[model samples]
Target: MPDLLVKLSWSLLCLAHLVPAAALLQPSLLVPLYDVDPASGAGLLLRHRAALFLAVALVCAYAALAPDGRRAAGLVVSVSVVGFLVLYVGAGAPAGALRTVALTDALLLPPLTVAVWSAWRA
Candidate 1:
């Protein structure tokens, strides 16, 4: 059961990242994804951000499938999501499409805590 929780959480992390990663190929996705204009100067940087998210997703998927990889993967995945939420709230939790992203992160917290505890138990 503990192993299951760990794997499930990692898989969820991958799914969360994959959405943003899709913007690497489809820059127009930025509008719905983050309300940024793809034609703006920020396009390049945002695409790069997509790539990074893809890398995270790959690592998370691997961790879900490979027991030996979970610890390191957990560190990477947790820091990414938790770090974003911290920065978001610290930034005053400004309202916008990004707020939805923040909400998503908040929703993931419970499962993330469960996974962490389960991992510790195992």
Candidate 2:
């Protein structure tokens, strides 16, 4: 049951990263999902952000498959998400879709932390 929970947590992390990755990779595709202007400089920035998300997703997926590295992987994922949340909130409460994303990240922290703790104990 613990193993299943760990896998589920990691899977969720991968999915969390994947969403932004897909949106950033193709901003136009997210036009309906987010309020981003694909033609603007922000759109270009999102593309760059996509690369980062892809990296995180890869790490998460790898961790889920490789039990040995689950602890470190969970830590990395937790820290990254927490850091992003801090920055997002410090930036003065984002509006619209960004706010939703930030909230999602905030909510992910607890589960990610638990996953890391469990993996460490195991």
Candidate 3:
């Protein structure tokens, strides 16, 4: 069960990274998901942020496969998740499309945290 949880958690984290990476790589693809105006400035920002997300995703993929740095990777991911949540909430409640994103992040937090914990314990 512990192993399963760890794997599941790792997979979820990978997905978390992949989704944004895709959006960043092709902002047009995520038009419905984010429901934002496809302005040049916004697109540029998304692409810039996507680079960071890609880095995180690559690190997480490596951590999932390699035992040596799993803890560090988990820490990085956990911190980033928390930071995003904080910023999101602190900025005031999201509305419309972003509200959906906030909800998804809220739902993902528990499992992701648990996965990191279980992986560390194992």
Candidate 4:
């Protein structure tokens, strides 16, 4: 039950990081997600990618192994999920309707949210 949800969330988070790492190695792999906009330079995108990987690893590991860590990670996951949803809707499909928000941003919603709710109810 709870253990299953936590493990699934952690595994999905790891998968998210690994996918981007593969893309970071190749120039062609990045072009689709990061277009050459004036505000978005290559260096910034690289830095952002690295930061996301770090976050995913740190949070996922903590949530998976530590009881207290799950509470904190659950909080972050809840807030981030809701925030992405709001940002996507407010921006009026800025990144191609629901493409970005619908894909990667959706991974944390159900299991994380349920785990957090269960924790609170416990």
TM-score of each: 0.89, 0.84, 0.82, 0.67
Best candidate (score: TM-score): 1
**Candidate 2 backbone collisions, by pair:** none
What tens-digit string does per-residue lDDT give for candidate 2 at 3-120? 7777888888988889888866577855654576778787777777777888888888988788888877887787779888888889998788878878889888866876788778
Q: Model 4: runs farther than 4 Å from truth?
A: 17-29, 36-46, 95-98
- The alpha-carbon RMSD values of the candidates against the true structure, listed in the order shown, are 1.6, 2.1, 2.1, 3.6
- For model 1, where is the 10-residue window of minimal lDDT? 113-122
Worst 10 residues of 3 by lDDT: 29-38
Model 3: how far is 85 from its true place, Å? 1.2
Q: For candidate 3, report its TM-score.
A: 0.82
Candidate 3 per-residue lDDT over residues 1-122, each given as its tens digit = 46666666777887787777887757785567666555667767767777787877777787767767678888877776777778889989778776776776777787678767765777
Candidate 3 Cα errors over 4 Å, as ranges: 119-122
Ranking by TM-score: 1, 2, 3, 4
lDDT of 1 by residue, 27-116 (tens): 999999899888887877888999999998998899788867767777777887899999999999999988998998888787667655
111 in model 1: Cα distance from truth in Å? 2.6
Better of 1 and 2 by TM-score: 1
